[model samples]
Target: MKFGDMELYILSDGTLTEDGGGIFEYYPKNIWASYEVDGMTPYRTDEHNNILAAANCLLIRHPEGNVLVETGVHDKTLNYVKYHNIVKNPSLMESMKSAGFKPSDIDIVINSHLNPDHVGWNTVIEDGRLKPTFENAKYVIQKKEFRKAMDPGFELKNDYFSAEEDVLPLEGSGTLELVEGEKEIFPGISVIPTPGHTSGHQSVMIRAERTMLYAADMAALVMHQEKPRCKMAFDALGREECWRTKKKLLYDRAAENSWYTYFYHETSFSVGIIHKITNTRGEMEGRVEKVEIL
Candidate 1:
């Protein structure tokens, strides 16, 4: 997907098959199952009602430099992959290699948040020790998110389980750069705080004449972007705040500006433009529709 002078590539860390209950949480299965985007169901389900979602990351070939957004679940030795029955695919490194780039090619790595799945590739295990994966790239993240991940009380410990191994090592390598609130990492690429999934969750915006918003987990699925209320079980931390963040970014900004958007876990399709439309109930709704750029 070319954004004006820049090119955007969607690379998968892998696909995860999880129970619907874990994906939807409070959102009833029947209600979400009935909803479709552009006459196509957004998720693939099995007999056991497990949803297959893609852990997608974006690589931007920019004039300034190569930028990577959201590294996928990088830990295979972890018990969660076995406990949750996660189906691993080609890792972020392999995907990047297939895309004709290597670790040194990445100048910056923007982490939306420090969840295990999102920051897994920040470090790699070598010589029986954890070290920065992208040795030459500067790992950019929000300061608030770093502090929270470093000391996420007992209640939130599970979410940041890999932080000690994946993220903390970046600081030691002097590759970690923490910014507060909104800041532009490059001339046209910026990170905007879209807190809800986590206190410091953020989304990346690639701006040209039109903007492309990397919704990350803010809208993990196409359905989540279409209906902000239908949240994931992982959204337990700030469920209410998540909805508000969706409204602000998905509806108020993306839809209003018709920005091209990317959903991190949307397996079928990840990049598209958001459109606002009125439903039969006379309520305004956001629809993510794919558009061709001329």
Candidate 2:
């Protein structure tokens, strides 16, 4: 988990399940089910073809402070996940503590997007009011994403962004800092705009002696990294744009063995080096190698 002098570790806020058909929107159930993600609970699909998924959050132990990227789904979402027979784990706070930190120990939180599973820990219902979980940390997100999450039409994204439960409380906390495209969130870390997954979806980029872009749900699982052009149903905003983002991240930036990549929801291998593979015809593409921290 140590990339040079920088430190990194993954914490589980627990796991959840999604309609396998829902996450990989464009792919048929047969094609997707054919792909397998090791280290993940053997994906159990229900009559609806839903599969259990993990909410693996990344933590960066930087000298500036500790940064947590993404969180698990709220307990409120358990019924849906359990209906598929997938089990949830401890709270994000307990997971952090078990990993030797506390909720208040987090210095900054980078939400890849406004999705419920990604931003659930942003606020916790306490005393009948939404309360900030990390009192001292600043919450960062793309400015464009914040705007998109607030738009009326985005109500369709309510499952991803709960206005009253998630957004307003964090926005009102004065700890929220909306980042412009590719802006640094302190030092050692930056964000790249990946708009197709959501109107303002962004991926976290860490740079120090080494570099790694937390691809987030962009590659919801390792299979996407193995296949960049793969499509997802949840990409309601920009399908083509999302595909371009995948190419730019996996084939371009992550090409030439320049940087490592992290898949937020990848159950088995969340972080790895994406190697650009060249076939006999000299055509090029990207796929992950060196699966680590399973």
Candidate 3:
């Protein structure tokens, strides 16, 4: 994945499982069953069946230093994300080691959002307190998202985020850098606002010889764009906004078949270009045909 001055690597943080009901409305029951987390659950229970997803963190290497995107889940936050499975023997440290770097070597961490699964590795529980996991990294977050997450909400819809375990630790470390809207993190790396999954959720864009969009929760799963519409069960926060964002990304990058997009929660194949496939009705359709790089 070498393009221009940037070399991008997709490292595995492990996997997760969420209820099938997390998808949006309008689909048929049998069709929805396919959304279940496992092959054995193709006929899975809608209310109980879980959808297995992966925690894929991206690592961008440059002449200056390394930039990590998303940091698997932490053990302390397991109660919030019970379905999450850190299958990796020792979690992110092992993944980072395989990539030729250590947690302490990361100079920056760009959080796609503060969901427990996404920011779990941001801190570690040490002696009854949370501490920064990446001792040398400064985290980048959207001001808008941070405010909303900080504001009150029922656990109701907000238990997925833990400010104490994830945010406050960084705050105490004085390494949290809040930015407005979308901005470029460095020469070739940029974070673009693609709200909906979370009011402040943003995706990452890397521009080198080719363009790639890390469609965070905005399009969490690759199958999300496989269907005619982009909908999710947990889209309660920004329903309307989520639809629009998904549409634009699908039409522009996925449909147009330009950018090499990455789905934050996909397991089968994460990186690929979407193409239009013909259906039995002789109509054109969108599907994510998997392909690998590096």
Candidate 4:
């Protein structure tokens, strides 16, 4: 969908389905279990635990060039067996084509964080050579994020990897821009530092008269936004800060009344607005409504 002159699209490199328990290991078992109802729970779960589904990436286009918010799964190396039924075979090229964009046409690629799911399509295997997918675009990532990923002792293998293959190659080719906190990468696009998920994790905020926040992992789902105290099991800095950041974003946006928020794992392929309504007991409830695809 198009937002003003900005064209937004979903590029599905692929989907990853995880167990619900694995997602919220940081939260108490009782607290997590309270959310389950009927036979089906709102959170994705395997036989033993609950999980969150990593949806596709958001592709944004402006008159100057194209900006891809996140890159989805790169290839079949990562497990796809569990999600085979729910996630259709991913063809990012086809998805881009459907949205009226080509790989070569993308001019800017932004890595919200260095997570495997977020940077999966950063490099594509072509004739056995791992190369940048967006040939002409400069890859923008946080300086601290790149540094943390580059650290050899980083324990999480799946989360951080060799900069040689994933990140440094782009820098070597002079196609990387490592920006500091709250830096403007484009005229209307800015990166806001939102740590806790990762040391350098950042959220993308697009500004106009009305603003849109493409909050990457800050609030993975509606439930996370609703219950800010809830935490993701995979969070690096524990749950408290994550919850604090989530609450701040949710409350701040609701107070503003004009900000459109989008989550990476949101079910719909559109922008959502949060509304507050008073309950029968005079308690405020937040409702998010999808406003537009862009």
- Which numbered prediction scores highest in lDDT against the true structure? 1
lDDT of 4 at 72: 67
lDDT of 4 by residue, 146-260 (tens): 8888773646555674345666557676678898988887788888888878888888887766678876776676555545455576777766787566666655564247477
Q: Please, what is the whole-model Cα lDDT of each candidate in the order they appear?
A: 0.82, 0.74, 0.72, 0.68
TM-score between model 4 and native: 0.84
Candidate 2 deviant stretches above 4 angstroms: 36-44, 77-86, 152-155, 279-283
**Reference-based TM-score, model 1:** 0.93
Which tens-of-lDDT digit does each residue in 107-165 have in candidate 3?
Answer: 88999878677887888878988788888988999987677667637742364457666
- Structural similarity to truth (TM-score) of each candidate: 0.93, 0.89, 0.86, 0.84
Ranking by lDDT: 1, 2, 3, 4
Residue 246 deviation, candidate 4, in Å?
2.8
| Prediction 3 TM-score vs. true | 0.86
lDDT, model 2, position 55: 82
lDDT of 1 by residue, 48-134 (tens): 888777788899999989999987884645587865556557777888999899988999999999988788788888999888888
Best prediction by TM-score = 1
RMSD of each: 1.9, 2.6, 3.3, 3.6
Q: After superposition, how far is residue 84 of candidate 1 from its true place, in Å?
A: 3.5
